[model samples]
Target: MSEAATRRGTTSIAPPDLLASLDPLLREWLPRQRWFAGKGRPVTGFALISATELLEPPLASPGVIHLLVQAEQHHQPIHVAGTPGHSSAPHADDCYQLLIGVRKALPPHLAPALIGHVTHGPLAGQTVYEGLHDPGIAELLLERLRLPGRLGELRFGRDTRVDIPFGLVPRALGAEQSNTSLVYGDTFILKLFRRVVPGVNPDLELPRALARQGCGRVPAPVAWFESHQPGAAAEPLVLGVLQPYLKGSADGWELALRMLAEGADFSGEARALGRATAEVHLALSRALPTATLGHTQVEQIAKGMTERLEAAAQAVPALRPYAPGLRSAFDALAQLGAEGRIWTAQRVHGDLHLGQCLRAPSGDWSIIDFEGEPARPLGERRMPQPTVRDVAGMLRSFDYAARSHQPWAPEWADTCRAAYCRGYAEASGSDPRTEPVILRAYETDKAVYEVLYEARHRPDWLPVPLAAVRRLAAPDPARDPGSGR
Candidate 1:
């Protein structure tokens, strides 16, 4: 087919017949993917949002297809005695981006990326595998980004100030959770968001803002691509971002684990990490709109936290007994709001942690992955939040690392937490420790979130957050002097 014919084809570049044959394979293959969100529930069906042919027969050896598909799954209905308990809609739809590569025969090296044989599709008897694993597909994607233009519904763009080098070797990084990354010639790493939504993702939005502010703690994006919906009013969904890859850098997670193994102190590194975080926060505050949470907003924040706790308690029976104790943390915030105490809020790294940071050999810390919590709505992730939320996340990370160590090192976590707060205070001029009420509330909220997440995803790790739940529930007078013990 000619390029014009392909453009004029049906909205779904992959024909309906092809989708029908591909559905069963996806239902089987998707759940196994680490990036797939609908793991526990059964995939009822898949709806193709859009598809584009990046490469096909005659032009390329193996065809490459880019797809935006939604996976629908049903949640268990709640039963109540008073009413006939019928939920409005039992199913939920999660949109995902997939790059599928099709070939005639399976290659030994690419066997791991195989989805399975399509019994009846446009190309029946064609072998399909993940596109990122195919060098040809990766090269083609980079080429598209190199030249800014629109291809079908997808738009490719790059930072004009920086010239992107061509013919760079590509290799996908395997350690990511909800996204896949391809490192090109050890110079640029392109992150492909697997689970996609219909707005500008923070991973792309915040970096551009920080870059404009001349922030050195975060890497700026050099190239990116997004797909526009057919409707005029629909927003473009970001598909991927290409940024400079930091060579000879180690992530904070591995560094922390190694330090723990060597029975070394991590307080110095934690303090530096804290300072790095404060720098990023300062830059973001300067670059973005900042707000002061009024009494009404404070009350709403407390109410939201309380609501999350209630929902978590209902879902996980283990959280039921400690619900009252947990409620106190949020209630303290509400009480502070009642007293007319206000706090500053700004754009922050919504989901900050050890793994989100990298340390160069020179011992400089660089924060990465501003996508925030993957489970959160796009609007919520982009909203200006109290910086303490990020501080709480890092503190919890230290606790998590300590717990992962043999025999559990609570003292180490405590020392590191204090050091981190001190470093933040030194850099930001405001100490999180002084704002005990709000800090405790955010920490408690983070712990509740962790509990629910661990219970649902990693049952073995449930004990880690439960330990925090127990401690936060019964705030020690000595450890948490301002927790209203």
Candidate 2:
């Protein structure tokens, strides 16, 4: 976390000598927070694009914090855009982020609380917007929503391109760990990289590869945006990108929950999802095909997680209970590695939980979100550990949904689990008997990672994954929980 990672409206008594006035500035700043998104720290590193300072009144305007352009090396710059809040003080520092081609600003009520400052590079149009309040914002905000950074520029390969249609009203679709998504209309969604990892976004990179194999289920890319130049200090930064949106598509987890809710009879649905996923795997194999899973990668998965779990235990002692046992599991994995696993690494989904899968109303199951675990490094998420790793991610989702609404008994989760396993096996064409050992190992590895994640984030949910670790660490049941097949 950087020093400037948090900046709620509050100011330090010895606030920095920035140009903006203290009172009005702080008052307007507080409400712009993303609850799960990190908030509350003195903003230290800042560059400006344009400033639509509201020197007047009534919920000061600009309507929404739609977009801005001045430059942190801004792409499209807009200089002054706000409705002007009432203020008696004289303003001096006139620098502003340039919001390019500002046709309109949003209605007042719908404006988001926090808006961008300045942007630089490869952009054309611009707008400024405030944060969105759940119940509703003023009308100005609703009218003014900025299109995400340069959707026009995203290029997946030398030939393929993505196009985003305007006026789609792509509202914010809660973010995954790594990316913040906004779904526009019923057609497309834009995933803005939050902590951009280097190379190309796996979400953008691998999907293109899968698409090349002509996979039907994965949302085909319409466009992609990336920083022309990688920042020396920034390994992960959102340049921007867009994808064909699956309006009625349900993620694998949500789908599982629905099946569980409907009495755990996802035979048809699960089988379809399974078939679609298997076909995807096959398509991936054809695209950036690989031959074998390396021992190093497997050991790394286990070893890496064990280290993280150990580190987490240091911070949260409650996590200590599972550490020793987990280490034993990792030790066991060390003996086997990801040895002789028939599947090889191509570009696999880094994180393959139910949340990652989208089920369209048409009954076609499409997978999305190439960016792996948001917390892990880009390289880590992009790496191919084991095919079962992805399978385990889905299985984990099944457990989550089963017990999603019911935490204590988790009876429902069992049903979802059974459906998921059945689905995976049929789809992947694996024999149930063969996959369990490997799946259990992968599950253990995944649980360890989850343990660390929960311990660090939702301490209350720590048990959600910790409990998984305990299960994974237990004796290997006859069925390979790893292979959904």
Candidate 3:
């Protein structure tokens, strides 16, 4: 598999075993990997869309891959992968063979326009070309990238092109923000989720409920996939979500770090972000569904935290010092369970972090990615916790923003931390009294978990959470109330 040096119209010496070319084995292999989106998916079969083999010289050195494989998804070919496997496959040519899938044959009208793309160039001492050159094959290529029109047909409306169709054989846009994304023809994006939680994925459910509840800011759901005849596992897995891609938007973390690093005043930005985030919690409470965040749920979550913490301590010895303290905090919170006060439950962003939020255009803060922490098993993730747990998570994130922005400068870290808490309190009208016990408990729990988390994945950043654990054990100096309200 030598590197393709040029591009041009191509020829295949051996008629590809369309099945081998379909890459069924690769699809089978995909579901088993960590990076694959179809976690529990049962891949039935694959369809082949005549891949443009740019180079396959006899001495092409066995396994160096430069491929453009169009694989079938549900019997229709799609531009599935651009690069090879997460790691290179076992057999040189055989590994790439599984990357193939099917393509839908496009309608006759689109033929002429699609065929215009077939051209020639040098790639691996050979000529490579793709586009509608094989009008028959090209039509098959085009159909796999599109869907039927609004009703009976399958093409998206013509004007849907964002990046528009380029002559480039489309590539499967990989996973992002915990959801799978595929950019086809540069006109549409397909998002798929790996963990198929039984109930509705909150990403769609809450946003739809909030929009009906008049909550703005969520990208309105345009099209969704759910079985009309619901199956045992028919909780819509969010196969794809169609929304206008935010142009010129940096993820909230990137924006915050840039703002903080530049020493720019972020008072207004902090306020707006806090307001929107607070509003999200409030909205989750107000509209959408509510269940008791009661003792039953609390005890289960406590047991889980205990298990995870104990396991963390076992695996990462550095986390031992905080185990007793972490256990104490959990026990103290469990006291509420003994008293039967764990009753307030609302739908929450299971995992809320800076990376999950976006600073959209117009300076509005938009929170996306409802999928919980990836490492947690699905059953554990579905458990209900206090909505303030989410608040606690984000509050921790603001601290993260400052610390992450300038590791060397401790100056003004306190000021930035206070401004953020100030923003949250003012927007949500959060009272320290109603949830004081639980809020502190949750925040403490978050910091301890952060300590254990940083120890494993990022040893360098371990001290931040260690310091936070110390700060939480003592009163947060930044949290002193002016009016005691």
Residue 5 lDDT in candidate 3: 23
Per-residue lDDT tens digits of candidate 1, residues 1-485? 23343332133334577678889999999989999876657889988888887776324567888889999888755332222322222236889999999888778999999998888867578878888998878988887887677887898888989987767999989988899999999999999999999998999999999999999999999999999989999999999999999999998989998999999998999889889999999999999999999899999999999999998777677777889999999998999998999999999999999999999999999999999998888999999999999999998899999999998888888888888887898889987888878888899999999987776667788889988898888855345522211
Q: Number of clashing pairs, model 2?
A: 89
Worst 10 residues of 3 by lDDT: 87-96
What is the C-alpha lDDT profile of model 2 across 300-412, one tens digit per residue? 65677677656556555555666676576566666666454444566567678777777777777888777776556566766655566676676776566654555343555
Whichever of 1 and 3 has more TM-score, that candidate is 1
Superposing all C-alpha atoms, what RMSD in Å does each candidate have to the true structure?
4.1, 11.9, 11.8
Q: Residue 369: error of model 3 in Å?
A: 1.3
Q: Tens-digit lDDT track for model 3 on 348-448? A: 77778777777767788777766567555545555555777776776677677767765543443445445555667787786432555566667767776
The lDDT values for all models are: 0.85, 0.50, 0.50
lDDT of 2 at 122: 16
Candidate 2 has an lDDT of: 0.50
Per-residue lDDT value at 355 in model 1:
95
